[model samples]
Target: MTVLSQLVSLVFGGLVPGFLLGLLAFRVKSRWCPRCGESTLAMPPTERDR
Candidate 1:
């Protein structure tokens, strides 16, 4: 009983969270462009002095 309980804790508590976090990481994209290394589209262009 004790060994089974420990195994369940390791799988449900530790492994489950880690696997979920990995899955989440794949779905979410950061604000920056990875290829060009540019700031996200939200960034504004610089203004020139007249």
Candidate 2:
């Protein structure tokens, strides 16, 4: 019973949160455009800026 409880805690407390945080970090770090390496958050420049 103790072993089973420890296994459950290790999986739920460690593995699950680690996986979720890794996924979030991957998404946040991977949102840049491949060609220009620019973030998608900015609006494209207008003709006036060209």
Candidate 3:
């Protein structure tokens, strides 16, 4: 029972927050495309984009 509880704690404490942080980082970086390196902007550009 103790070992199982320890394992569950480890997974929740170590893995869950890490996974959530990774997802947050991914979402933030996803604004810029990896191939073209262009950022997704919320507002339209005032001038034509080159």
Candidate 4:
């Protein structure tokens, strides 16, 4: 039981937060792209970040 609970906690703590952060990053990138007149598809989310 202890091991199972730890595994569950790891999944929620790591995977869930990473997924949510990625979603927020995507949203911010899209919102900022138009200001530079770059096509969102051409500019990678990581590249526009610079």
Candidate 5:
């Protein structure tokens, strides 16, 4: 019972927040496009390479 509780806590305390933070970071990063008003990740490599 203790082990199971620990596992649940670890998932909720660690993985959940980590996943949320990663999602937030991705959203923030993708939304920032000062140059072209589009996600840089969506740009073609050739366009950015030059």
Candidate 6:
């Protein structure tokens, strides 16, 4: 029973959070345009800037 408890704690406390953070990082990185290496959500340049 003690070993089972420790295994559960290790999985839930460490692995779950680590997996979630990695997934979030991957999602955020995917938002960038690969060719230009710019964020896909970046605003278009206005006439004033041209």
Question: What TM-score would each prediction reach against the true structure?
Answer: 0.45, 0.59, 0.64, 0.53, 0.50, 0.64
lDDT of each: 0.77, 0.89, 0.88, 0.81, 0.84, 0.93
Off by over 4 Å in 6: 42-45
What does the lDDT read for residue 41 in candidate 3?
63
Sequence-dependent TM-score of model 1: 0.45
TM-score of 4: 0.53
**Residue 40's lDDT in candidate 1:** 67
Stretches off by above 4 angstroms in model 1 are 20-29
Residues 1-50, model 6: lDDT tens digits: 99999999988899888999999999999999989998889798999999
lDDT of 3 by residue, 1-50 (tens): 99999999988999888999999999999899788988776866566773
Show how many residue pairs clash in every candidate, following the order shown: 0, 0, 0, 0, 0, 0
- Which sections of candidate 5 miss by over 4 Å? 33-50
TM-score of 6: 0.64
On residues 11-50, what C-alpha lDDT tens digit does candidate 2 reach at each position?
Answer: 8898888999999998987888779988978788999999
Q: Compared with the true structure, what per-residue lDDT tens digits does model 1 show for residues 1-50?
A: 99999999877898888998988886565656789877665745567632
RMSD of each: 3.7, 2.6, 2.9, 9.8, 6.4, 2.2
**Candidate 3 lDDT (Cα, whole model)?**
0.88
| lDDT: the better of candidates 2 and 4 | 2
- Superposed by TM-score, candidate 2 places the C-alpha of residue 43 at a distance from the truth, in angstroms, of 1.6
TM-score, model 5 to reference: 0.50
